[model samples]
Target: MTENKNNRTITWIVGGILILLLAGVSVLLISEKKVNKELTQEFELEKEDLENQYTTFARQYDELKLTVSNDSLSSLLEQEQLKTQRLLEELRTVKSSNAREIRRLRNELATLRKVMISYINQIDSLNRLTAQQKEIIADVTQKYNAASATINNLSQEKKALNQKVTLAAQLDATAIEVTPLNKRNKRTKRTKNIVQLKIDFVISKNITAQTGEKTLYVRITKPDNDVLTKNDADVFAYENRNLRYSIKKYIEYTGEEQPVTVYWDVEEFLYAGTYRIDIFTDGNLIGSQNFSLN
Candidate 1:
């Protein structure tokens, strides 16, 4: 009877061990399933974040196109933009459980970022160079304008100096006298008795004037303001037009005061009124005088 009891006790112990092992296996399986679910959730979140990054990179390429003016650079940016969009589409279609594909796409995102940074640096360099060129052009233009203004000022100064020199070199006449003579060559105040008129003048000394031969014109006017000339064509230049003169004399000037005399024979009828005499040289009126006759 004792032997039988020992065998039964052994069987009961074996059965308890088997039941404990099955319960431990069931707990292990449940824990493993929970861990797997958490891992899958983490992978999905990572994939969503990666997709967002790719979308943002694509949008950035569009913005970069707006900043570039070069046609070749714009074309390159367009290619990059399209590439980023294609990668984004591929990322969206990929299963979250595909870790290999997700990792590869992530590496591609890094490479795209590096390429975009390089392009940005290139664009910045080009912009800085263009700004420098504009500054140089503006500086050159300002200097040219300053030089032109200086030249104009110099030209005006030279013209003014020339005008001053011309004025300083002009000849002047002074000490003028006129005497009416009768048929006996004697001074007379009677207009009807006058047969000739004598004119005398002195040229003033001027060292600046040219020392050479010069022509002098003398005009005599009657009481009626009529110029006395031998012929209508007896003319000399005064200002810009020709004027009738009673007498023309040639003299050699030595830049010294010199006395001159001229005469006119009265051929027309005379009246009792004031008469005038004028002398000119080098197109300038040099002297004038008026006298009364009876």
Candidate 2:
């Protein structure tokens, strides 16, 4: 009986040990599963945080790109940089257990790298374009300066040419000769009643004249230093203004010098003395001469 009792006690002890081993294994399995679950939850949280951060960074980069200068290509480059950040985040988030997802992330990362390279190339191209634009602007400015200088030179030359033409067309004052029919010398004395005074003048052959109606004006000085001219109401056209003349005559003077004859009857008293006569035509005092009457 004691042997049977000892065998039963040994069986019971072995069974209890097995039960304890099973319980320990169950507890261990549960603990391990709980730890694994916690690790999975932590990893998911980390991945989600990375995704959120990457998304936020991408948005910030986009907004920053929008604020870039209008003339720069930095916007595209920044976009690629943001894309690279997002792809890196995705690459880190995808687990090894999800092979397809990891592969997708790898592909995305490769695409992002290509896009970044493209942006780099674009930057190089933009730099080249900027240099080219600078050169073009410089060329245009130089051309404009040259053109302005040429125009200024042309204007100066034109002004000089105009001055020369005007000088060539000018009329001289000493080219007129006059004569009184009965005037012999400066000391000749004349009666108070003079019948008429016949005046004659000659124009210089070098006088530049146009073929137009030229009105000649005459001003005669009497013996008493009196200017013998008609009143302002008897104004006549001569030298581009209203003039007073004792007599009016029209002449068609060609370019060649010609003689002009004018006759004036003295209605007023003519004291005998030296008399000066002025002839004008075409905005110039063409000639002047003196004579005496007896």
Candidate that would win on lDDT:
1
Per-residue lDDT over 1-294 for candidate 1, one digit per residue giving the tens place of the 0 to 100 score: 999999999999999898999889998999999998998999999999999999999999988988898899999999999999999999999999999999999999999999999999989998898889889988998999899889888889988888888777888878889898999999998888999988889999989999999999999888878898999999987788999999999999999999999888888887888888898898789889897788
Go through the candidates in order and give each one's C-alpha lDDT. Answer: 0.91, 0.66
Distance from true location, Cα of 93 in model 1, Å: 7.3
Q: Largest TM-score belongs to which candidate?
A: 1
Model 2, runs deviating above 4 Å = 2-9, 12-38, 41-53, 56-113, 116-120, 123-127, 175-294
**Over all chains combined, what TM-score does candidate 1 have?**
0.64
- Give model 2's TM-score versus the native structure: 0.51
Candidate 1, residue 8: CA error in Å? 17
- Give the total clashing residue pairs for model 1: 0
